[model samples]
Target: MTSPRPHERLLASMMRALPESGIVLFGADSVFPMIAIFAARRWGKNLTVVSAVNTIDPRPDFLPYSTMDPPAGHRGSYVIPMAEAYDLVGRGEVDHIFVSAAQIDAHGALNSSVIRMDDGPDKRLPGGGGLAMILRTVSVVDAWKPVHLRRTFPPRVDFVTGVGNLRHVITPMAIMTMEEEELRVSSIRSGDTLDKVQDATEFTLQLTTKESGLSRAIAEPTAEEIDCIERVDPRGVRYATEVY
Candidate 1:
């Protein structure tokens, strides 16, 4: 069997962060909705996807560019206003939410707003549409970044758009979690090392240990998980670069 690609392994890692039986609300990004659907199918009958477009429970046949895209909500059981969905989050009905950031800090505060520049015009990113409320209310927030770079994981974000319930930070190279209110390297991806992760990150890398007193590391994506990702996203939408 062929080895799993970085995105596939990242997707599998994201899937593991999800609850087996709860409503998972996905953010309006390129990759996470696909992961949400895979988790729903793999876990079977227990996982429900509340798409970013407010679809109650969508089972999209193919991956969409953004979760807010209409095709992402295709074949859904029903639709509800986004306000209602936020209500669900406020009521603690939603167990988990997937969020992304243009920049994230050591404290897990996110910046989806503008990137400050001293020499030139500041770059305005896609501002947090509803991230402030969702991040604050959701029980768990799993953030993913396709690229693992020093600028992406900074010691402090340029602007704080959201900062609540951020439990895990998933990137192409590693999986980090909150420890003592600071982001720590919980698991390095298979074939990746702490030195590589630290080189890509702006802050110091602190390794987390398992209950058995061993270091935590990401398991290679199982063959079954790779197969599911391939089946759902043959066009490789998950690998596409974000416009913003």
Candidate 2:
């Protein structure tokens, strides 16, 4: 049997990230970073795509073929700032945001900073880019909205750096979300079960069933879809493990 590919897996992961309505924002290229370049064209067509210049690298087809770039001073329904994406979340211009966390906690707090080890630090990641304020603005306080976090690293986050609307979490093994400050496991990846997910994470991640009973991972990849992922990111990095 053929395995799923990366870009396609990215798209499959993104499809699960979206809401049926309202403004959606993406923080980095790791997930659905921009609307103009939203990566969902291959699986289906006749989909609505909003384009943003100050955002992540978009799918090439969105360029001269399907979508027209936004003109200067255009106000997109949902906005993403390529330069200051984090700031937009604080102001409430975004309803949902997909961000990669250095480490995340059961309480939904994020830590984008690095671990201070004996040798200064092993790596320096992007520090809390407006995450604190965004967390305060997005959490149960501001309209009680939902945020999604994608982190491969775990164990209650080394430090609390950033914050998202923090509705759910997507990892290589599972899908999870917060319910009133409690981390709940959403769903297991397509091929994996809850036990497998628990074994992979560093911390004790609470698993709950997502409303959508599917993993962001391709339930079943098409020959073309699998081929597409190989053509783009041949390494076969799958990002969308959680469908929440």
Candidate 3:
């Protein structure tokens, strides 16, 4: 099999759209989050990458910001509280937030805070600190909806900690958006047709875009931006695979 192309990798997994400024909460080992961090840096948007535990950078050259604290492990949004997340966004320091979800609904709600446990009352994880605050306060967010572009999406979510105003959700197949409280298919992924992308998603969608395909918000890459993404994501490819 042929190796995936750079744009292919980026288009495939880097599906989340970001607000101009905000905080993104993701796991340190998450591949999509890593790609988002790289792309967010290229866009020159102000961002805060929040992890439950401490993370250190070995090759810190690629990231625009460095991770503080040492290698440690913990659970919960132990470092920060949900209310403080409100303070951050309210103070203009944060305008959006990203939380990796285990389930998504047509309305663009995420259920990353809930985890199914064996014979138990479905364990709930601290999805992220400020997702609830970000949604209610920031009024905007970027997310690839409909369950990572597949059947994991449903008519209603199991739980909603943060109902992201879901500015955008990039899937392996297409870009999703909010059209009057409903998630709509705004942009088709390059090399795929609308029907092709639609067939891959679980939720029903309506097209709101005219010329829609994989295009950046800025469209063209700046010299510094290109250099940055290429440095960490060398080969100009983004890693969205679960293995990464």
Winning model by TM-score: 1
lDDT of 3 by residue, 1-244 (tens): 2444444344334523554555554433344455556466556666655543432122233332222222212232345554554465666554444445677678888776885656878877757555566566664556643234454566677787678556666665556767678777776545677777667667776876544343523123334444555565554334334321
What is the C-alpha lDDT profile of model 1 across 1-244, one tens digit per residue? Answer: 8777777777887777777677887766645545545654664537777877778778777777776678777788989797888788888888887788899999989999999999999999989877898788888888988789899989999999999899888887888888788988888876788999999999887876444221367788888777777777777787676311
lDDT, each prediction: 0.78, 0.48, 0.53
Q: Candidates' TM-scores?
A: 0.90, 0.61, 0.63
Model 3 regions lying over 4 Å from their true place: 1-16, 19-31, 38-59, 62-86, 90-92, 115-128, 145-149, 209-227, 234-240
Query: For candidate 1, what is the lDDT?
Result: 0.78
Candidate 1, residue 80: lDDT:
76
Which of the predicted structures, 2 or 3, would earn the higher lDDT when compared with the native? 3
After superposition, which runs of candidate 1 have C-alpha atoms over 4 Å from their true positions? Answer: 43-45, 209-215, 242-244
lDDT measured at residue 27 in model 1 versus the true structure, 0 to 100: 60
lDDT of 3: 0.53
Task: Give a tens-digit lDDT track for model 2, residues 101-143.
Answer: 5566667777777765675746778776556776666422111
